[model samples]
Target: MKPAGQTHTLAVVGASTLLGKEILEVLKERAFPVARIFTAGGAETAPDLPVLDLGDSYQDDVLVEEPEDSEPDYVFLADRLRPAPEGTNLGLLHSAERLAEAEHSKVIDLGGFMLPKAGGAVRIPSLEREGRAPERLDSPATSYYVAPHPAVVVIARLLLGLSERFAVESAVGEVFGSASEIGPRAIAELQKQTLNLLSFQKIPQAVFGAQMAFNLLPRLGRGRTQPGEPAPLERRIRDELRDYMGGHVPLPALRFVQAPVFHSLAVSLYVRTREPAPLAALGEALAAPGVRLRRISEGPPSPVEVTGSSDILVDALTADPAHPEGFWIWAVADNLRLAAVNAVEIAESLKSGGP
Candidate 1:
């Protein structure tokens, strides 16, 4: 096992993406023991990190060939879209098997392609319920580590806290998303469309397929959920939630939405507890390490408030008038930052012990 201060090199696939950039930022912000940085999928080169082109002719290799001394100790797959667009990281992470075969490097995927042969279960470092054992990285059962979906991170942290107090029966809510969830191109297109709309110019229908600027969508970009399959984003949350919570509670009625913001998620959730609890008792449950309850004086929580912050900001909480056991909770999280932080947290979790 690696010592805590022993520096490790990280190869960030899709380094040009929003989540990719955020991962780099979080790594530095937390002062992780990063010996060096390597980036993929960008035209302009970053100052310190060397670039690796994942071209079409790029050999399908897991141990990314680099200077022997600078070989990545771990890889962070942050591109949200799979089969990365042409000229992007040479489509790295398209197959998890190649990564698993790497003799030296460990792979931790944020959110992208499905892993090889069932992949590993989703992990939310913050709400690792019931003192569960950390998912072993070298276990044959785990092809790679998946960072828990950010929206689910928010829901899990908050709802589970309440469950510890009230035994939450069910939760129903819509998670509002931002362009950042779709990566850099989506953000750029949204910005372009917004400016064009204000200038009376023709809006670009690319990226999101429809005008996403100042608009909301049930789902965004390409890909569709097949029959009996949950929508891509929705499935991740549902599956991960179950994996973490087990059969202790029923899955929430949740839907993923694409909102017109650049970053952060505004989740509207209504939760029903097993027994009636006063508003004060339920409100107390919102106070957890990664969760911060909003102050009534601070106005409603929005993306602007959480744009660069680490914590998942939640506020606008109110108990249902008739059913005192049911409460409304609104949450906003910097999606990229939350996911990036969790990725690093998962890495830290590994340091405690790993094969």
Candidate 2:
């Protein structure tokens, strides 16, 4: 295991996009102890953000100048291996897999490069071939683990901590993905079309299959599978949840839909409990640490309202007398922020020793 209380250095490979920016924000918000921070992106100018210039490699412990006082640690190829200077501490990777090949003291991946298996151990066929498995790490020390999307992981941990009687019956996710989720070109097109007044005469479908302005696309990536078949994202979530819950809880049925909003993701859950759960108790339970509960009388939650908010907004906690088993509620969160924050939390958990 890695030594505790060690000052670490972090490098974010793709730090130009919204998720990347949010990752920086979350790290600062949490006040994570860091000796240096490195941010790399494809863009020439990332205004208001401090990033290292990878123009050339510096000697061990060398410091470079930025426009401001802030600067990153070092720059490694997204997939190429670049060793940090000897005696370096930990690496927190977000949304970049190639960096995993780097020769760091310890690497905490925020991408889904590895999957937790039905059994206790994790599966990393790719890393295994490269001779970078759990066993490779000095027994119990210097171990590496893949962390799943932060939002999903944190929510799973929160729910498991709350109660065992509650079952996530069904979940509907309205994802307000950032423009960066698609790419830079797609973002440029969206802005161009917005200025052009949604006229298809000039703009063509680029990032998304359809023109995504003043309109919402229900589907993302591709078509949903058959009724019984799970969508790709949904399947991943179910599988990961089962692994995290350790089969102690049942997997919830899920539905995912994409909205036109620029950022954030909102999910509404209808839970069925083994015993009747009162609305007040349910609200209080959800309002526990890692979740934010909102109370509303008339209108439903929307993506526009919840964008840029860190907490998972939970409202519409209404008990269904017809369905005596449980009740329903709405939850909203900044998807990228949730993902970024959750990733940091997982790293912290692993560092502290997880349950």
Candidate 3:
């Protein structure tokens, strides 16, 4: 680990993005030490944010047009840069590569795109052993570190926690994703669609390819992600869970549905263990750092209530009547905030030279 007072230089690639902004907020909230900070992005990014002059080739250097300084020690690809768009599913791997090579910075991708296209180490701070670094983190070949999708984190953490006490047989999960998961464009389209529908006007469907105001979609509309394939979000969650779970537990059967809400993510999970486990014992296992257990009397959590909370709010625990080993769990997490926290925590671990 670096010395107590030592600091590192940093940069955020999509500083103006929803996740990018949240990440900055979390970094500030956690008081990450920094000797300098830099930012870059497309037209939507703030005018003052420096634009990196990355040429067409990987051989090109990461040239900062303003705020001349040495390359940052770490670079965070927080979201996709707009206008010069790098599609929804692939992210800006080319840009990330340039930043990592030319600038010589350790790149951490929060953009859900990188890992699926190109391999990387998945980091979930909550799951790591207390002090020892995971082998992936210590490996020289791992160039990028990824923060798992919020749904993946919630499901993985819950199952991992439960497995500590019971032998989990299998599980199934239904994730309700919100507009903000797609970024500001989707949020704006949903808002516009809502207002347009109320006014009896034709609703805009450009961003989501359908009226997303009050309707739910199994996948995006026409011109958006195709219905024949696994939704990108679902694929992402599945891939992440596979890596994070690391064969320690059975991978849950998952379905991702796009919900009308503008923020947060919710999951309804059914878990079957090898033996019947008491609710009291399961609750004890579920309570841990970065998680909140709500009492049944307090009512089930809603996406709205979990919007700003960093902790994953879990409640509405109940046992299945027919299957002695079966039970259901309902969990809600601030989509952006949970992801931001996980990213920041990963940075902290990297900063401290720990897992």
Residue clash pairs of candidate 2: 1-140, 1-141, 37-72, 79-98
lDDT by residue (1-355, candidate 2, tens digit) is 2324664565554455545555666666666665556644433223322121112121223221221222233332122222333443333232234333444423444444323311122222222232322232223433344444433543454354335335544433332344434444555656665656645456546666666767766555445467557656666665655555444445555655545555556665556776777777766655444455666765666655666665666665878778887666666666666666655554455444541
lDDT of 3 by residue, 284-320 (tens): 8887877788888897889988887898999958899
Q: lDDT score, residue 164, model 1?
A: 66
In model 2, the runs with Cα more than 4 Å from the true position are 1-6, 40-104, 114-142, 154-158, 165-180, 183-202, 221-231, 298-301, 349-355
Regions of candidate 1 where Cα sits further than 4 Å from its true position? 1-5, 42-71, 80-95, 112-114, 129-143, 221-223, 226-230
Cα-lDDT of candidate 3: 0.74
Candidate 1 or 2, higher lDDT? 1
lDDT of 3 at 346: 84
Residue pairs with backbone atoms closer than 3 Å in model 1 (clashes): 54-90
Could you give candidate 1's per-residue lDDT for residues 62-180 as a string of tens digits?
A: 22332233336778877532444555442334445555566566677877454544457567766663433234344355436778778877877777777666777888979888876
Quote each prediction's TM-score: 0.81, 0.66, 0.84
List lDDT for all candidates, in order. 0.69, 0.48, 0.74
Rate residue 135 of model 1 by lDDT.
41
Please tell me which predicted candidate would have the highest lDDT against the true structure. Answer: 3
